[model samples]
Target: MVMKVLFAGTPEVALPSLELLAGDREHFEVVSVLTRPDAPSGRGRRLMPSPVKEAALRLGLPVLESDPSDPSFPDVVKATGARYAAVVAYGRILRQPVLDALEGGWYNLHFSLLPQWRGAAPVQRSIWSGDTVTGATVFRLTKGMDEGPILSQSTVEIGPDENAGQLLDRLAQDGSRLLAASLEAVGEGRARLVPQSPGAYEVARKITGEDAHIRFDVPAFAADRQIRACTPEPGAWCLLHAEGGRDDTGLVLHVLRARPLPADDRAAPRDLPAGRLARTKRQVWVGTKSNPLELLEVKPAGKKAMKAADWARGARLADDAWCG
Candidate 1:
């Protein structure tokens, strides 16, 4: 007996899971897709459909546009008569009515391990926290936010130089497979739900432009985390003094990659007077508080991203310029 399934997701992460459902069409039917309303984009500000909604349309499935908090959402899902609902990166909370509408239960594909990082921005939070290992979880959805019972999980080792965007892409692929297996378990009556243990949980709050500023006074390692966390979105940048001793300019310096320098080599730019450009043949290292950040790649304001070595060669970086 095939189980009718309703898939609700938004964003690139949701695409892989949707593909998995499409592949296993024999066991599940994606009755309809629920996505956020279209929004204006690009320089022209033309309205654009979401990737999820577009995929749903290509598959000839009905696409519903409604806020999760709207009174009509539960009714829409109920009309589908789907036995199960798969929620992934949906960007909206599922109320009790939507959860109860499913015959079996609502399963969520979360980017982080259950009970750990459960909230708005799991992937970004995990990278910022410097977790050596992180993974995805398929859990039985509950009234609480990501505070549901876990069914299965798969771990991914964090690479030394991986950023939030890169790591999230990998996690999304893993999550697709994991979600498929979890659905199989549910179909076969072998689904096991594990409730989260009571303790302090780290919430993944939405990152803001204010959160992306790199503070030079902080330890270089701390600054490195913020740089990785805000990549491909609100970039992490340091304020730099433009030429002619004019007012300070907001230089959008994107740290493409970096690593913690040796303890003995750590030097704060303030320790020296100012305007310092510490460099090496391969990479130009920037001194912050306590430690030095080896800038593997950087994008200066109004410029294309280039290697630190290239930037160092082209720009006349004073030995004390980087100090500020």
Candidate 2:
């Protein structure tokens, strides 16, 4: 007998799990999908369906476009007749009657391991902190923030050069497979959920523009981590500093891509002081406490993204161009 599954998600990160369940004919049937309603998007702020909603429509799955805060939410969930729900980045909390609405249970696929970075934006937080290890968790959905018992977990290495978007894409893919297997285990009545250890969890707060601000006073490695974590959203940026001037003047330059300081450059500040920018014919670099960080792509205010070296050339900066 195929189990009827209700899918709940809101962003592109959740698409993999939705697609995986929908494609499986032998085990689970995705009877319906619950996603956030159309919201303003893009530069024009026109109404647009969420990525999950768009994909759900493409998959021919019924979509419940409602928030948990709605008075009719529990009734709507009950109406679907899908006792079990698979949630991934649903962007809302499931409350009492709503949790009770699904008799079987609600299982969430979180982007971080339980008791570690348990909140929204786990992937971004992990990178910002220079955590070399992180993973995904499939767990029961409780009223608490990812405090439910763990159904399963899959550990993954944080690639040295990978950004938040890149790491998230990888986790979503890998987590989909893990979720499917866990669901299969549940179906076979062989699933065992383990309770997480108590009271040692870390918080993963959402990234703000200030959180993404590049600080040249930090070491090159730390700066690299923060930059990669904020990439592609609320982008990591630094203020343009005129020679011998402070960065308080609001001249911002968004850093789209950065490379690790090469071994040869790691110990050498060269002619550049901390927060200073300079470039050779082949590369652009920004000085840090430890070394100069290689700058690959950047976008000055009101400008399109371009190679950092090109921007430097066009600006015709002095040898000690400042970018604090």
Candidate 3:
């Protein structure tokens, strides 16, 4: 018996699960795809369809667009006669009525294990906090944000140097398989629900522009985590002064890739201030409280990303020049 499922998602991270559910016709049938309306994108500000919408249209599935907050959304979903709804990065909070409309309820493929990182921007928050391990969760959707009973989950180790974008790509692929297995169990009436322990989880809130600036007063490793978490999105940036010590007139350089230097490698002269810029023949290093960070890649404002060594050579930075 094939269970009809309504799919809701937007963005590239949700693509794998959407495709998986649509292709598994024997066990589940995608009744319709609901995504946000087209929005402006790129330098031209042209309206563009979401990745999920594009994928659904390519597969000949009906697509619906509307704000989930609209009171009539439950009716709209109920009209589809979908036995279940699967949501992955849908970017909206569903109301109680909407939750009740689907006969089998909604199953969400969250990027982090709930009740941890339950809000928006889970992948980014996990990396920002220097978590050693993170995973995906398939859970029953409720009124509260990510406060749902778990259907299934799969864990993955967080690589030391992994950034938010790289980690999300891996989790998206792994999550699709977990979602599929959970769906099968639900369909066969053999699925188990595990309630999350109260007061045992941390929240993963959205990232803001203020969070992207690198602070040199903190430990080098913390600064490294900030750089990786902010990369590929609101990039981590610092102001760089010329060798002549004109702090008032400096260039803002976005740090795209960086790593912390070991304790021995960070030993510097007592007079060297934090945010000081130093360079070896092949690499660019910046001072922090505990140690210095080696800049592997960087982008000057309004310029393309390039190797830090290349940028340093082009700028003709003096040995004593500093950045903050």
Candidate 4:
């Protein structure tokens, strides 16, 4: 008794769950995959199929690309004869009508635990806020954002040095296993639904360019979290001040990897202004309010990423040079 499932998702994170459903032929049949339309990507802006679309095509599944605003969207879903819809990072919110069209309703696999990080950018927001533990949740779909009753969840520990990209990759794999089990329970009419408790809720808003700037006025740990959160996308960047007024305008450099120097290891004067730069024989440090951060890797505006020490040598920064 294989249940027919309508899969909806986009992006690389969604591929694992999509593939898992497609491979579970005994218990589930992926009738069709719904994803966002092809859009321009990369520097050349060439139209590209989403990661889910590519995977769905490779599995010999039909794909539908449409927004919720389309008048015929509900009809398209109804025609699939899919009783259950499993969504992950679908990149679009579903209207009530669309959810009603499905015979068994919709289920969404969110990257964060329910009632926390309930909006977009959950993985990035969790790391940005320095949370030590985060996990995935599969819940029934409703009009409210991630407010539906929980169907299944699995927790994962966040590594102290993990960035959003790495954490997401790991969670995606864990979530696929959880999603498969939940789908099986649903098909057998044995899944439990738990309502979220009343309490303070945090929203995981989308990240913007403004959030990518490294703020040295905060504690070293805070700055480190910001850099980790923005790594690999909308990268954390800082302006470098050149000595001798060679470039008073400053140069933009992306911070790829960094660590906050412990108080005992900090050698600079405590009163040094934030955003100042200092260097040892083999390492480069940036002053913050509480301590300095050791820049391990960086990428100049037009160059590939390299060791921060290498960039420091190329710029010939004086011992007293500063960056903002």
lDDT of 3 by residue, 1-324 (tens): 798999999999999999998998999999999999999999999999999999999999999897878988899998887989999998988889989999898999999978889888888889989898989999999988898899998899989999888999999999999998998899889999999879966778777777887898888899999988887777788888867486477888899999987777644333345788877668888878887788899999899999998998888887778777
Question: What does candidate 4's lDDT look like per residue over 1-324, in tens digits?
Answer: 799999999999999999999998998999999999999998999999999999999999999997777778899998988999999999998888998999887999999988899998899999999899999999999998899999988999999989999999999999999998998898899999999877889999998878898899998899999999998777999878767253587888899999987778756446556888877668888888888888999999999999998888888886667767
List TM-score per model, in order.
0.90, 0.94, 0.94, 0.95
Weakest ten-residue segment in model 1 by summed lDDT: 267-276
Candidate 4 off by > 4 Å: 244-247, 266-271
RMSD list, candidates in order: 2.8, 1.9, 1.9, 1.7
- Best prediction by lDDT: 4
Candidate 2: which pairs clash? none
Q: What lDDT does each candidate get?
A: 0.79, 0.87, 0.88, 0.89
Clashing pairs in 4: none
Q: Give one digit per residue, the lDDT tens place, for model 2 in 1-324.
A: 577889999999999999999999899999899998899988999999999999999999999987788788899998898868999999987887888888778988999877899998899999988888889999988788888889899999999999999999999999999998888887777889898889776799999988888988888888888899999878999888645455458478999988757658544357456788777676888888876788989999999999987888886666656886
Best by TM-score: 4
lDDT minimum window of 10 residues, candidate 3: 264-273
User: What is the lDDT for 167 in model 3?
Assistant: 93
Residue 230, model 1: Cα distance from true site in angstroms: 1.8
Q: Whose lDDT is higher: candidate 1's or candidate 3's? A: 3
Q: For model 2, what is the alpha-carbon lDDT of residue 309? A: 78
